[model samples]
Target: MSATFVDVEDVRQRLGSFGVWIAPMTLLTTPVATQRAQFARIESLGYGSLWSGEPPADSPMGGREAFAEHGVMLAATERIVVGTGVANITRRDPAAMHSGAATLAEAYPGRFILGIGGQTGDSPLSQLRAYLDGMDAAATQVLSETAYPRLLAALGPKTHDVAAQRTHGVHPFMQPVEHTANARRLLGPEPLLIPHQFLMLNEDAETARGAIRSVFGSDAGLPNGFYANNFRRLGFTDDDLLDGLSDRFIDAVLAWGGRDDIVSRSRAHLHAGADHVLLHPIAHDLTAAVDQLELLAPLLHN
Candidate 1:
């Protein structure tokens, strides 16, 4: 399989060293102006891209439609790239996803990326293959020639192969820097690798960890869970899996401490071969998330 999308390097440059991942805009009934304002502020702070996803409204992270939010964010900022860290494939048909993504890419030009995932198929790869087929069939000439970047929210080799062959690369969330190293080895140094890092500005380990747990811990340890399976693949123990996650597990997955600690953590992923690391600040609301990023900007921005 060969890649139809070929503008990977340009996308990498636009992503810079760190981009933010949050759903504060669509998570609430926040005014569009406010959404634009917050996005503008982050761009002004010198962050490269701002990533978000299409989570269900009732989801613990709060729901926001990916494309709609991407549009608003794109309209709000002039330089910062906006991406759907993933728009759930299970939630929309291929044609709809293609149309929405193309519209954004055309409007935003090189500033938008159509990162997609969240498949519920029995045969995950086969299911995603079909999904891409539908999306491709629906593609327009402008979109095909635009070469707007795309990615799969993949964590393992199989899906990484799919991403390498089809889209630009993979966006692995909830994994550590080691996962970035392993993904780089799997991708063999060309395909784009953007891993999401959970960050908290809290000083106390327990408080910071508790915030991450409230967001991702409940879904761990499931026999059929993707994140739990990814954890095992990364060599975390069953002991690390049980009892609200071992301290080691929490430490590996979440970056918490002073400015230097968080900055070093992001650098670790970049050193591990990630082209860009999407920083997910563990905050209860948009205001807090934005404030945290501002505090880290002095050390984090490239």
Candidate 2:
């Protein structure tokens, strides 16, 4: 596979060192004006980037498209970069994905990063390679200049190798700092290593663990999901994954407790060789999530 034509330095310069990943589904369902205000508030809070996921077809916002949402977010904010924490490649062909990414890159310029993931067929690595090849070919046909910066949601070593060779970086989701260190070592020093860290502002250990348990449920023990498999690879035994994640597993993966604790966990990723850490604050209410972002802003910015 060939290297992406997008300028990696420009992407690094734009994304900065810290970002927030919010589903923004709540805001999307709200009135247009309110949604815009919410985005503006996040940007004002000093986050370098705002990351959102590609909603499923049955999403509450009437199947809101990721590329379209990226445009809306860019329009709503002044300086904050907006990106897909990952747009599912299985949902769209590579040509469509390339066009959507290129359109956002053209309109927002430095303010858009295209992160894509989700396995497509029998072999995910092979599918990803084909997808990248298709994107490169599509760029030649449609986009004469300005390739969009892309990040892959890679987890294991094989996928990390593919990301190192093809895309701008790897955006491993739901892994601990140990995985971040391993990814950095595998990808070497040049490629960006941006890992997502789940955050819970609650000081109560049981409460935070409960939230994580609800999120993972039976999947925590299953060997199928990416989180389970990655955790196992990182030396978490079946015992740790049983009963919706053990207390030990919760502390290892989540950035919970007081403000200081959250800050410490966030910094651990940086210390582990991550270029940037995307904090995924877990809260049902959008208002509460925004408040959490405000509270963590000073610590993260510093």
- For each candidate, the alpha-carbon lDDT, in order, equals 0.82, 0.81
Q: Write the per-residue lDDT of candidate 2 for residues 81-126, one digit (tens) a residue.
A: 8888788886688888888888888887788888898774578788
Candidate number with greatest lDDT: 1
Q: Give residue 164's error in model 1 in angstroms.
A: 1.0
- Cα TM-score per model: 0.92, 0.92
Q: How well does candidate 1 match the true structure in TM-score terms?
A: 0.92
User: Can you write out model 1's per-residue Cα lDDT over 3-43, one digit (the tens) per residue?
Assistant: 24556777888789999998544355666777788889999
Runs in model 1 lying further than 4 Å from the true structure: 1-5, 24-26, 56-62, 140-144, 216-223
